[model samples]
Target: CLGVAIFKKKDSVEGTREVYKDQRGRILVVEFIYGGMNFRLINIYVPNIEVDRREILEELKGLVVGKCIIVGDFNIKCSRLDVGKGVKVRWEKSRGIGMLMEIMREKGLLDVWRYENPEKREFTRRQLKEGTLKQRLHDKSHAIFNAHLVSKAVL
Candidate 1:
């Protein structure tokens, strides 16, 4: 299961900051919980396609929380290396995704995946052969910003 919630105040945060579950029934939330010592966790699902992912980024910038560990599938993509290949007809329709990337940059949302895996590989759409959702470019099909997490605090 996935969850999305926004809180205004900073000091008002406490236990179970945000409640959510996973495929194996694990309770998840956003808060400062250090691993066996000190840390925090913040899970988010920035809207894509229809809504702007920047809103969430702005909200994060507005808040002054401690040791945040945000993790979620921010449905977005910028280049073909992120996904695979895309069709020009469908590529033109993914303007929202481009905006989401901009928002992420403006809000200082670092791509943890990119940092963790610098080799540059596609994580989703393994089934798409070579003519599904990509344009007729050299590398533009897997251009979706899917399955990733952005965070300011380390885990």
Candidate 2:
């Protein structure tokens, strides 16, 4: 089971509301008032398995409307660059990834880190209970935010 939440300064937010959540606890989305506009924070735990991951993404696509961000593992590599040095095994030749990219394109949600540092190859390494895998992209979480929404909430 996965859980997601956002902790913000008390005064900086208002009108907190939950937008969506999955039965398996895979996704959690909430809306709140910030900078005088409503913004959504979406967090998800994408399964490593390809088929399951794709199903979650499909259900999530419809919810990708308006002033929101979708953040999750997506369990995929957006491009070859997302794979680290000597990590060709990490590349997933899956259509689920393409669908995810399409969803992002339609909603204008950009992976914050990727958008900012296009030329840099960065990886966050850690040890899960199962084990540690170097140069793996899925373990790292993504913060996908609408570019327009980010710029407007500059308070």
Candidate 3:
């Protein structure tokens, strides 16, 4: 039942699959034309295991042309910057995360929320363990990239 839902404005013209589902119910991507600009919105759900990481990243690499905004639950812990308080965690270097970072660097994508709130500690999902609040990093991070000319009004 894992999926992604997109609600678009009525004026936008939709396009074909910029990226299709590499795995059923796991990845969904769409392209749109708004104000004469192309925008690709990727919605993904990476499993909480390590095996699917390569497949996910490969699918993502295929979809990185033109303007894109990738949004999804990447079930990997990639950075300490997205972690909040109450639990101490270290950043472990992984091949999947390294690929993702490389993609971001090569494609000119930015972590939208983290860019806006650099020093702030917040969590999109939190859990209580041993009577202490531990914020899990999965839902708290979203990777949003702007590849082409973005309007000042949209900023």
lDDT to native, each model: 0.46, 0.62, 0.60
Ranking by lDDT: 2, 3, 1
TM-score of candidate 1 on Cα atoms, chains taken together:
0.50
lDDT of 1 by residue, 1-155 (tens): 33554354664444434433333222245443333434345545556435344555454444424444454545554554554434232556654566555545554555665666555665533444575454221122222343333445443
Clashing pairs in model 3?
Answer: none
Give each model a TM-score.
0.50, 0.76, 0.74
Clash total of candidate 2? 0
How many clashing pairs does model 1 include? 27
**Residue pairs with backbone overlap in model 2:** none
Candidate 1's C-alpha runs over 4 A off are: 1-29, 35-38, 52-57, 86-109, 127-155
Off by over 4 Å in 3: 12-19, 137-155
What is the lDDT for 45 in model 2? 68
TM-score, prediction 3: 0.74
Instruction: Sort the predicted structures by TM-score, highest score first.
Output: 2, 3, 1
